[model samples]
Target: DQQVKQNSPSLSVQEGRISILNCDYTNSMFDYFLWYKKYPAEGPTFLISISSIKDKNEDGRFTVFLNKSAKHLSLHIVPSQPGDSAVYFCAASHGGYQKVTFGTGTKLQVIP
Candidate 1:
C-alpha cells in the first residue's frame, strides 16, 4: 500500500491567484512533512516543510499545513506566477530518519 498519496494529478490556476495542493498519508508515524517543486529536466527542490508539532509553516508566497490527527497536509501558493508551474511532491519522514516517502506528485499549471 502506498503510504503517501496525492489525489489530484494536476491543478490549474490563473496568474496572481492561489494554488492549493492536497496530500494524504496512511502512516501515522510520520512527524515531518515537506513539499518539493520540480521543473522539467531538473531535480526537485525543497519548498516548504512542517513538523508534526506545528500546524502551519510559511515562507514568502509558499505555505504548508499539516493535520496530524487526520494524516493530511496541503501546500498553498499565493499569487501564483508562471514560474510557479511545476510538479509538486509531498514528502513525509519520521523522527531523525533520513528516509522519506513521497507522494505521486501534483502538476500545477499557472496560466498567464
Candidate 2:
C-alpha cells in the first residue's frame, strides 16, 4: 500500500503567486518527513523537511507543515517563479530508515 499520496498530479500557478501542494499519509509511525524538488531527467534535490516533533519548518521561499493528528502534510511556495516549475515529491521515514516512499509526483508549472 502507498503510505503517501498526492491527490493532484499537477498544479499550475502564475509567477508572484502562491503554490500549494497537499499530501496525505496512512502511516502513523512516520516521524521524519521530507520534500524534494526535481527537474527534468535529474535526481530529486532536498528542499525542506520536518520532524514529527514540530508542526512547521521553513527555509527561504519554501515552507513545509506537518499535522501528525491528521497524517497530512503540505508544501507552500510563495511568489513562485518560472524556475520553480518541476515535480515535487513528499516522503516520510521512521526508525532511522531512509527508504523514502515517493508520491507519483506533483508537477508545479509556474507561468510567467
Candidate 3:
C-alpha cells in the first residue's frame, strides 16, 4: 500500500507555462518531504524539499508548498521547459529520513 498518492498520472503543459503537480498523503506524522524528477532510465533526481515547520520552500523556478492540515502538497514549475518533461515523484518521511515513502509519480510533458 502507498502512503503517498499523486492523483494525476500525467500532465501536459505548453512551454513557458506554469505546471502544477499535486500530491496527498495518508499519514500526518511525516515531517520531511521531497520531490524528485526522473527521466526514462535514470534514477530520480531531487527537485525541492520542505519541512513540516515551513509551509513553503522555493528554489529558482521551482516551488513547493505544504498544507499539513490537508496532508497535501504541490510542486509548481514556472516557465516550464521541454527539458523539464519527466516523471515526478512525491516522497515523505519522518524521524530524520530513516525511511521514505513515494507516490506512484506523475509524468509531465512540456510541449515546445
Candidate 4:
C-alpha cells in the first residue's frame, strides 16, 4: 500500500505559469505534514508545512494546503521559473512516532 502517494511522477510548465502538485495519505494517525524540494544529489530543502490544526501555509512563491478531513494535500508554485525544476517530496509523521513517511516525489519542469 502506498501510505503516502504522489500520483504524478513529473509535471512540465511554461515559465511564469502556475504549477500544482498533488499528494494523498492513507494513515489516519498522521498529524504533521511537510513539503521538501530537492535538486539532483542534494538534500531536500524545507519548503512549507502545516500541522493538522491548520489548513494552509505559504511562503514566498510556494504555498501548501492541507485538508485533514480529506486526507489530501497539494503544493502550488506561482510564476514558475526554470530554477524551480526539481523534485518535490511530500512527507507526514505521526506525532508520537519519530519516523516520517515520504511520497515517491514529483518532478516539476519549468520551461523557459
lDDT at position 59, candidate 4: 90
Give the alpha carbon lDDT tens digit for every residue of 1-112 in model 2.
9899999999999999999999999989888999999998999999999999999999999999998999999999997999999999998888656688787789999999
Predicted candidate 1 versus true structure: per-residue lDDT over 1-112, tens digit per residue = 8999999999999999999999999999888999999998999899999999999999999999888888999999999999999999999999946798999999999999
State the displacement of the C-alpha of residue 44, model 3, in Å, after optimal TM-score superposition: 0.8
Listing every candidate in turn, what is its Cα RMSD in Å to the true structure after a full C-alpha superposition?
0.8, 0.9, 0.6, 1.2
lDDT of each: 0.94, 0.92, 0.96, 0.93
Model 3 misplacement above 4 A: none
lDDT for model 2: 0.92
- lDDT of candidate 1? 0.94
Question: In order, how many clashes per candidate?
Answer: 0, 0, 0, 0
- List candidate 4 segments past 4 Å from native: none
lDDT winner among the candidates?
A: 3
* Candidate 1 local lDDT, residue 80: 97
Clash pairs (backbone) in predicted model 2? none
**Over the stretch 28-94, how does candidate 4's per-residue lDDT look in tens digits?**
9999989999999899998888889999889999889998888999999998999999999999999
Model 2, residue 28: what's the lDDT?
91
- Comparison by TM-score, 1 against 4, better one: 1
Is candidate 2 or 3 superior in lDDT? 3
**Candidate 4 clashing pairs?**
none
